[model samples]
Target: MRQGLTWFNIASLLLGFLFLYLPIALLIIYSFNESRLVTVWAGFSTKWYAEMLQNQGLLNAGWVTLKVAFTSSCFATVLGTMAGLIMSRFGSFHGRTLFSGMIYAPLVMPEVITGLSLLLMFVAVALDRGFVTVTLAHITFSMCYVAVVVQSRLAGFDRSIEEAAMDLGCPPGRTFFQITLPIIAPAVVAGWLLSFTLSLDDLVIASFTTGPGATTLPMKIYSQVRLGVTPEINAVCTILVGLVATGVLTASLITRRQEMRREAEERQAIANS
Candidate 1:
């Protein structure tokens, strides 16, 4: 027999959700307000969104953010996968402790320190601070996140499948690509999305590394916030939230459908056997 939720449980859950999402809900609702002030809801209107469209600076910043997020996430995923594979499959090697420490240190390090260190490193290397520097910085930090995700997925992987592939005359490279990659593809994709979100949401690091004409969306938002809160910012934030929600929903649907199909195929194979 299934027990229904008690009043206490329901109340607690409702309170938790409200505490987490109330600010976001208010911001989204106010984005449609006709009044210039974000706190006072005059009436529902899309004027702020329209005005936001005409803002060239915001558009440029968004474009730069998208580019950097995509590039950095892609590079981070590849490098992180390699790092995870090395640590998981290779057992031990020279400098293993140092490599592992470097990979995980960013997780606990302060963003201010990370940003300042990267800035100093860039200056010492004489690398011009701009989109390239920002992208590199994002990849450097985001790769650690990806590595952690991939490593967790790899920890539970079955080695018997790989051995079977090799027994069937498959080379090491072929076994990895055909068997291991498919098994870990979900984790890799998850890592990429995490890296992308981190790159897009980062402010302090991007601010430190960004030069003129290379502002990201987070940096742009921060600059506007210093002036004051406006409905325009709320509208922009709402749009961004919607985009992220849509992307996540679409990815989840795709993954679910693929998993169902894979399950059906496996069931059919079992029946045939």
Candidate 2:
């Protein structure tokens, strides 16, 4: 029975990994495939990547996407860090629960509904559907992701440090800028990157809100894929995957270094005493 269970677990692990990886593997493989019919192997070639380089529309869309991502991430990080700080520091209040729900509501709410609602709100307010409007929509959802990341980081932080800074006659703003922000900087930065990635990847909401000449890379990819899938799209996907992997590796390394430094300092103090 134990042997049977072990086999079952091994099978499950393989199955789960395959399920998670097969599509991505296929996408990466397809990018190198020379055939226009993406499924059939027509010999490997780097022509599609070259094609991506030559396609001006795709390049323009990518630029737009980058702009939106950067702007949204910057605003989201600032707004979300503030929100997380407030939600944590203020603790319970008359409408704290409601505020918390509102902040997190986006994560659970249907994307289609959120998209439609934002579209309607824009229309109702007579806001023109353009790059600015799309950025606003992106920032709305991006900020929610930032809030989630910052909030989790805040959970692990001890409040005593800020109090100590204040007790030392530091101004409130000085305490935050000097102590709290540094402690929370990693989380804030991670949140910003997350927001940027989400903004770049978003299609459905962007589709609803984006106007003429405001095409994002995802929108361009989706439009092209609807007509026909190509290695160019696959190349773009591979690039995104590579970028995300790089970001994750960098963050992990930084966090590990910080942890090791803390441990070393603690050990040194212990040995000295």
Task: Give model 2's TM-score versus the native structure.
Answer: 0.89
Q: Could you give candidate 1's per-residue lDDT for residues 1-273 as a string of tens digits? A: 248878888899999999999999999999999999778879989999999999999999999999999999999999999999988988889999999999999999999999999999999999999999999999999999889878876886768889999999999999999999998888788788878878878999998999988899989998999999989899889988876776566545645654665577668778998
Q: What Cα-based lDDT does every candidate model obtain? A: 0.88, 0.86
TM-score of each candidate structure, all chains considered together: 0.86, 0.89
Cα displacement (angstroms), candidate 1, residue 87, comes to 1.7
Candidate 1 lDDT: 0.88
On TM-score, the candidate that comes out on top is: 2
- Residue ranges of candidate 1 with Cα displaced over 4 Å: 1-13, 246-273
Error of 1 at 95 (Å): 2.8
